[model samples]
Target: MTNVELKEKIIEYSKEIGIDKIGFASADPFLTLKDRLLEQQRLQYQSGFEEKDIDKRVTPKKLLPEAKTIIAIALAYPSKMKNEPKNKKGERRGRFCRASWGEDYHRVLQNRLEKLEDYIMSLVPEAACKSMVDTGELSDRAVAERAGIGWSGKNCAIITPEFGSYVYLGEMITTLSLPPDTPITDQCGTCNKCVEACPTDALVQGGQLNSNKCIAYLTQTKDFLPKQYRKQIGNRLYGCDTCQQVCPENKGRDIHSNEEFEPDPDIVKPLLIPILQLSNREFRENYGPLAGSWRGKKPIQRNAIIALGNYKEESAIEVLEDLLLHDPRPIIRGSAAWALGQINTERSALSLYRAKETEKDSDIVKEINEALDYITSEVRYAK
Candidate 1:
């Protein structure tokens, strides 16, 4: 078959193998990726690269020397899960934003991409693929735009007529000389809803994602989250789907995946009480299969407590207080104390007082005292 015929066959087989979208572009490095990469570097997020002398991404040419095209693909992940309340309830009512509520799309998309790649190699014995889903720092979003899959939105996610920004992107880098598709144009149409809705103003007025304030990066982060942005994260434990939720292009798209992306019912709008009580081992077993566990249960479970606090639900007080006493990590203890302050119950007050008496960590004791004072004031008002 000619290269054009081969490209057609590859994409057809890709869809048959279960990909939601498949398009091709040349293997050249991303045209507009340097500026974004520089910014990501300034924010200190560029550590995930191979610093070999050969310019790992665009050079040494041998690995991709004869490469004529790259296949940028996507698989649709469910936009919403079972218990995630619809937008009608009000902002921040749902548990997760949208895209992340399901199982990790990376694993599922990669598995399917491998099948397609294998089939291609069978037909062209010399074909080999450096296939990856969300790996290799190749700017999967950028390449997807070039391949006519979608255009990058102000939120930096690829958007197509059918899937919007809800699709998960993966790439197959290969030596096949597939005919490339024409690039797509930006369809944002002066829409700044995503930038405006961003709780953290991470996106500049135009359309830049300052990773430092992005909740998706913030929740998965290690170390301390700056106090200012912590509140902005609201209840998002793993990823934030807010910007996409408000985008005009994504409105009313009924796309959803029925594969490994299905969520565990308990995780959907989960009760903060037991989640705060989970031991490291239990958290592993419960969330390991899900993408939310990528940072381990500590950060997510910690954020769950914060989300409960954000709700200001008095019923969460005992749960937060209990976590204050049992949580081994100071970070968790500190967050629990903050939630207790927000809930402000008598039980929480007493626990904070007791914890304050024995606590050796100065910062934690201070947080406990703060929670105690706030809760005490609240209870007094109620009485």
Candidate 2:
């Protein structure tokens, strides 16, 4: 079969295998992306989770020799949950971002990529292919954008006309020569809602991000969250959606086409207090399937503690107190101390004092002292 015929067959088969969108691009070096990445590095803006070798990341041939084309795939995930649980007084819940709603997208996209790879190999017996999801060397967004999958939005997300920015991206590099699709025009004219709505101003400018200041990156960190950002994190247990939520293009774009991407309300929007008590095994068993759980239970539990503080839930004081005094991890204990300070009750203050006396971790001790000071100032102000 000719390359054009094979490409058409691949597109038809992609639809049969439930791939929502597919596009093709030449395996050229992403020179523009390389410049942006260099700028991000120079400005200390990277999230540090990306592949460090710039050459490998930008050059397709380094990943797969004689690569002729890249097949970019996008799968739309649900933006809204069905039968969403309400967060009430003592039963407040924290949320995982929309991307983390269902099964881990890594596995879901990998399965699709594998099937596509198998089909391609069957057609071209001598063809070589290399596939990767979000964790790959090549930038999935850059490939998708080049392949006319979507326009790169101001929020730094690829905004598909059909699915908005709510799509999971993956790509496959193949030796098969195929005609490339035209790049999409930027459609985000004059709309700066996403930039304005960023909670931490992590979007330094349109198409630029300072990942260190981003709540999505912060939620995945294992250490104690910085004092300034703790309050800004709100009830987000994993990832941040403020930028996407405020985008004009994303308005009324709630696609639920993929069953695998549908959320289990109770799991994605889990109660904050109950989350603090989940043991390692229990946490894994409950949240193991979701993409948000990749950072393990520590970050989620820490965010859950911050969410309780953000809510000022008086009922959580007991649990926060227990965590403050007895939790082995200093990040948890320190976060608990901060939460108690946010609660600012006399009982919470007592817990901080008790923890202050026994806490040997100097950092945690500092957190306890700060908590006590916050409560004392609040008490005096009230008086």
Candidate 3:
């Protein structure tokens, strides 16, 4: 069959296999993306989670030799959870971002990509193909934008007209030549809501991001969160959605096309106090299937502690104290110290004092001392 015929067949099969949207693009190097990446490196704005080799990331041929076209696919996920759990005062909750609401998108997208790859191989036995999801060397958003699947938004998310920005993107590089789609026009004309709404000013400008300051990147980190951004993190346990939430284009857009992406409210927004008690095995068994759990239980638990601090939940003081005094992980212990300070009651102050006396880790000791200082200042002010 001719390449055009094969492309048509692929598109039809994609819809059959539950791919929400598919677009085709040439496999040429992403020249514009390279310049932005270099700028990000020079500014030290990267989150350090990306592929180190810039050449490999921008050049599709480096990933799949003689690649002629990229087939980009987008699957819409639910933005709103049904039967969402309420965040009561005592039973405070931490939230996983909309992207992490469901089963790991990596697995869902990979399954679709594999099905598409097998179908392509069936048609052209000699054809070569390489598929990648979020973790791939090639940027999923860049490829999707190039393939006309969506316009890259100021929030740094690809915003599909149909699904808004609530879509998981994946792409396949193939030796088969196909007609490429036209790029989408930029729709974020004068609206600066996402940039302004960014709690940390991570969005330096439209289409630019300082990942180091991005809460989404910060949440995945396994260390004690930087003091400055801790309050800005609020109740987010996994990722930040402030930018997307404020975007006008994303208004009233909550697609639930894929059942696999539906969230379990209890899991995605769990009680802050109980999260502090989850053992590693229990955490894995409960949350391993979710995308937010990829960084392991440490970051999530640490963020949960921070969330409790943000809420100033009096009931969480006991659990936070236990973590501060007995948790083996320094990050957890230090975060608990900060949370106790936020609670700022006499009981919490006592816990900080107790931990301060026994805490030998210099870093954790500093956290405890700072907590004590904060409590002292608050108490003096009240008096």
Candidate 4:
């Protein structure tokens, strides 16, 4: 069959296998993907890698020597959820981000793309296939925009009129030169809400995101959190969704999905008490499939503690007390101690003072002492 026929077959099978939208782009490759990645890295914005990798991703044939066209797919996720039930008080907003609320999307898209490849190779038998979803340098958003799937919103996400920006992107690069879809025009005219709403000022002028200032990046990233950003983090434990949450264009598109994208009811507004007591294994089991995997449990637990501290949930002092002495990771323990100090409870204050008395590690002991001082201003205990 011809490449056009292959494109048709791909669209048919991709939709059949549960992808919401499938569009074709001649692997013109990521013109901006390479440059933006390089800019991010040069500005020290990347998770890893240097300018060289970014260069390759931006250049078409350089990225995939045999790549001809790319098949990009978008999966919509639920944009809204029921607020916490009144009985379950002290609930924090989601840290999992809107896109990662359900099953691992990487796994979901891989299964479908592999099937599409199998069907194509059934006819060609010699075509090469490499599927990627946020793994490599190829820009899924750029390809999606070029493929007529959607236009890139000022929030730096591709938004389909039908689904808004609450969609996940994945692509299959192959040796077939499929007929590319028409590109969409930019619709973010005179709109700056996404930029304005960003607490960290991650979104620069236009749709460009200054990664260093991006709360979503700093939250899970290995980089040290800027002093100003901690307060803005609020209760977000995983990824930040502030921009999309306030987008005017995203008012009420395909608001939710029946797919595995549905969040665990408990996850929508987590119980902070148990979260403070979570072990490494427990943390991994609960949020492993979600976006929290990258940071492990330290960040989530730390954020949970901060949320408790912010709410001044003195009742959670018991839960925080347990974590201070029992939690394995020093970061979690330190953050928990800091939280207990914020709760203004005598029990938290005494537990912290006792933990500080015996704690020898300078980093941890210092934090515990600081917390002790903050919680009990009148009690001047010698270190």
Candidate ordering by lDDT (highest first): 2, 3, 4, 1
TM-score of the candidate numbered 3? 0.99
lDDT of each: 0.73, 0.94, 0.93, 0.74
RMSD of candidates 1 onward, in order: 3.6, 0.7, 0.8, 3.7
Query: Pairing residues by index, what is the TM-score of model 4?
Result: 0.87
Model 4, 285-307: lDDT tens digits are 88787755666766776777777
lDDT of 1 by residue, 41-160 (tens): 677644343232223444313456676788888877666556554422222232544555566767887788889888998999888688776656466777788889998899979989
* Candidate 3 residue-wise lDDT at 361: 99
lDDT measured at residue 264 in model 2 versus the true structure, 0 to 100:
96
Lowest-sum lDDT 10-residue window in model 4: 85-94
Model 1 scores worst on lDDT over the 10 consecutive residues at 85-94
If candidate 4 were superposed on the true structure by all CA atoms, what would the RMSD be? 3.7
Stretches > 4 Å off in candidate 4: 49-52, 82-84, 87-95, 222-227, 369-383
Runs of candidate 1 with Cα error greater than 4 angstroms are 43-63, 82-94, 372-383
Q: Give lDDT: candidate 3, residue 209.
A: 97
lDDT of 2 by residue, 250-318 (tens): 889998877899999999999999999999999999999999999999999999999999999999999
Best candidate (score: lDDT): 2
